[model samples]
Target: MAVLPIVITGEPVLHTPAAPVTTIDDDLRSLVDDMFETMEAAPGVGLAAPQVGVGLRVFVYGWIDDDDVEHRGVAINPELWLSPLSTAPLHEMAESEGCLSVPGERYPLRRAHRVILRATDLEGEPYEVAAEGWLARIFQHEYDHLDGVLYVDRLDHTNAKTAAKAVKRAGWGTPGLSWMPGVDDLEG
Candidate 1:
């Protein structure tokens, strides 16, 4: 598996909705494997297809603690289902968040304390998983990318301003604040 180059902020693709994956074929499996490797290489908690320039509804991540075992894998066409608070498991909102596409920055975005997801594995097997805490937040964050939403978009105005300054200074424009793909001129 290869560690793919993550598409940074300012790219038009990140702003647009990602394509859905209809086939769970060999190619799809390979892409998932590569994504896992890429995520590990970058030492990140999650990675999405859009981050690697593949505008498909796919992502991979796992719950790993200080233990050496790094449980990791991929999710295809992931759909999140937030459990009802009444019968659902209890959860707590954790804020610290980051994105591969955004790069060199992190932000605090409020995310559900817990969540349930229905998705297919790389081999096309269906699975349902319930996660909470940081795992839940990470999955939610990556899933947002599949919908063309970035963590920055979820950041509070004050936090967003912090990122905006960094983005402007770095001069990265693929998926960050400075670039808008369809909008020829943002300031009319």
Candidate 2:
């Protein structure tokens, strides 16, 4: 498996809704493998297909829970259900989020603390995961990519403006921009 170039913000694929993964062929498996590698290299808990320039409803995630349990897998054409988010004030860094597509920028945004993620596995089997805490956030973040949404897009007025400025300063306001994980000295 190889680390693929992760598309930056403003890329059409990142903004357009991804198509469902209909055929579970060897090629799709290979892409899953590469996505895992890319995610590892990106040092991110999750990575979505559109972020890697593939317009498919797929994403890979790897995270260790507070109990020392490891959760890692690929979600193909996944559907997610989330619990209501708290209206309480965000705890600065504790509630902030970042994205591989919009690298190196993070801002506070409220998200459901729990989520139910359902999707097919690599072997064409269906499965569901009940996740909470950071894992839940990861699922929501990646799922948003499939629907052509980014975390920055959900930011409030002040944060949204700041995120846009960050994107502009990073020279990522246009299309056709990408960064190769493990090669590019950057992080999300």
Candidate 3:
């Protein structure tokens, strides 16, 4: 499997909702494998297909729980259910998250503390996961990508304004922007 170049925020594919994966063939399996490799190499907990310029509803995640139980899998054509977000203020360091597409930045955004993720696997079998804590956050973050929503977009007024400035400063916020994981010095 290869580590694909991850597209940046202004890329049209990332801002648009992804298409469903109706066929699970070798090509899809290979894409999943490559996504895993890319996510690992990017040193990110999760990744979505749209981030890699593939407008398909698929994502890969890998995270180890506090008990050291590893959670890793591909979610194809996923349907996610989230608990109501707490109206309480963001916990800053605890709630801040980074996105590979946004690159080199983390912002505090409120999110549900629990979620249920249901989807098919590479083997074309259905499965579900009930998650809380960081794993749940990962699922929500990646799921947002499938819906064409970036974490920065959900940031509060202050952070959102700052993020917009940063995006402009970096010469992003346009199409045809991408970076190779291992090859680029930037990481998010």
Candidate 4:
């Protein structure tokens, strides 16, 4: 697997919802491997298919520890299952999030503290994962990217303005950042 270039924000492909993978052929297998490679190279906890200019409902995420080092692996064609059985009600767990596509821009986003998801492996075997803490949040964030949503879209005004300035300073506009008020900074 090779590390592929990430498609920045504002790119037409990034704004469009990705297509579902109907077949688990060699090409799809190769793409999934490449996504993991790219994600590892980016040193991010997760990566999505659209970030690599592939419009597929696919993403990979893993847990990161205190040293800012990520634990590696891949999750393909992720299908989130918000458990309705928990009477405790999942609360917000805010964490600073970054993306392979957006590069250096980092912002905070609030996500569920726990989640259950059903996804297929690269081999097309069915697998179900129940994740909590950081892993759960990372999955949600990266999965959103498959649908053309960025972490910045979940930010508030103050953080959004700051993020905008960061994007402008970095010479990236909409193609590198998404603007929305009050949805992206609970954890920063």
Candidate 5:
């Protein structure tokens, strides 16, 4: 499998909702493989099809839980259900989130702490998984990409201002974004 170049935030594909995977065939399988490879090379815990310039409803995630359990899988045409976000203050619930598309930048954003993900696997088998904590955060972040929403879009006004300043300073506010060779190093 090859590592595909990840699209940056300004790319049109990153802003458009991804198309569903109509057929589960060899090409789909190959794309999944490449996505996994790319995620690994970038060292990101999760990645979506749109990030790789493939407008299909698919994403892959790999992460080690607090208990040291390794979890990895693919979600195709996934539907995400989030638990009620914490009633805590935004600053309390919001945590720093980063994205591969908007590399080298991070900002605080609030997200659900629990999620139920329903989707088909690479082989077209349906499955459901309940995730909490960081895993749930990953699901939400990647899910946003499927809908053309980036983590920055979820930032509160104060943080959004900060994030915007950073984006401009990095010269990433233009029509094209640069790809970072490694995975995002910021917390999510």
Candidate 6:
């Protein structure tokens, strides 16, 4: 597997909803492998296909829980069920979120406290995960990419303005985006 270049914001693919995976063939498996390598190389907790210029409903996640246990997997054509936003913890409201597509930025955005994610693995076998806290947040963030939504789009008015300025200063927001090498060096 090889680490793929991460697509930045301003790319049309990042704003368009991803297509569903029709078959779990070897190519799909290879893509998943590449995604995992890319995510790990970028050293991000999660990544979506759209972030890599692939318009397919696929994502990879690698995170360590509070218990220090590692949890990693791939989700293809995933469906997420979120708890009401009202139930999110008060502390989470102050937490900042970032994305691979929108590099070097983090904004505070309210999200659900829990999520039930259903998707198939590389082999087309179905799986489900019940996540909460940071894990849930990661799932929600990546899931948004499947629908062409970015974390910046969820920011409040003040933070949105701040993000806009930063994005503009970074020379992003154009129709095209640049790719960055070294996953661990990514700011998102």
List model 4 lDDT by residue over 134-176, tens digit each: 7777778877887888888777677778877776776665554
Judged by lDDT, which candidate is best? 3
Q: Which stretches in model 2 have alpha-carbon errors above 4 Å?
A: none
Over 72-107, each residue of candidate 1 has an lDDT whose tens digit, in order, gives 667888899864434342222336666766665877
Please write out the lDDT profile of model 2 over residues 1-188, one tens digit for every residue: 88999999999998899999989999999999999999999889999999989999999999988789999999999999999999888887988989988888889989999999999999999999999889999999999999999999999999999999999888886899999988997673
- TM-score, candidate number 6: 0.92
Name the lDDT of candidate 1: 0.75
TM-score of each: 0.82, 0.98, 0.98, 0.78, 0.92, 0.92
Shift in Å, residue 120, candidate 5? 0.3
Q: Sort by TM-score, best first: what order? A: 3, 2, 6, 5, 1, 4
| Candidate 1, residue 5: how far the Cα is off, in Å | 0.6
lDDT of each: 0.75, 0.93, 0.94, 0.70, 0.86, 0.85
Q: How far off is residue 40 in model 5, in Å?
A: 1.1
lDDT ranking from best to worst? 3, 2, 5, 6, 1, 4
Question: In candidate 3, what are the lDDT values of residues 33-112, reduced to their tens digit?
Answer: 99999999998999999999999999999998889999999999999999998988779999999999999988888889
After TM-score superposition, what is the CA distance of residue 76 in candidate 5 from its true location, in Å? 0.2
- What is the per-residue lDDT of model 5 for residues 138-158, given as tens digits with 9 covering 90 to 100? 999999999999999888888
Candidate 3 local lDDT, residue 59: 98
Clash pairs for candidate 5? 42-183
Q: Tell me how far the alpha carbon of residue 66 in candidate 3 is from the true structure, in angstroms, after superposition.
A: 2.2
RMSD of 5: 2.6
RMSDs, each prediction? 7.3, 1.0, 0.9, 6.7, 2.6, 2.1
Off by over 4 Å in 3: none
Worst window of 10 by summed lDDT in candidate 2? 179-188
Encode model 6's per-residue lDDT on 1-188: one tens digit a residue: 88888887788888999999998898888888888888777668998998888999999999988799888999999999999886444453456888877777777788898999999988779999999988899999999999999999888788889989998898898776756558245474
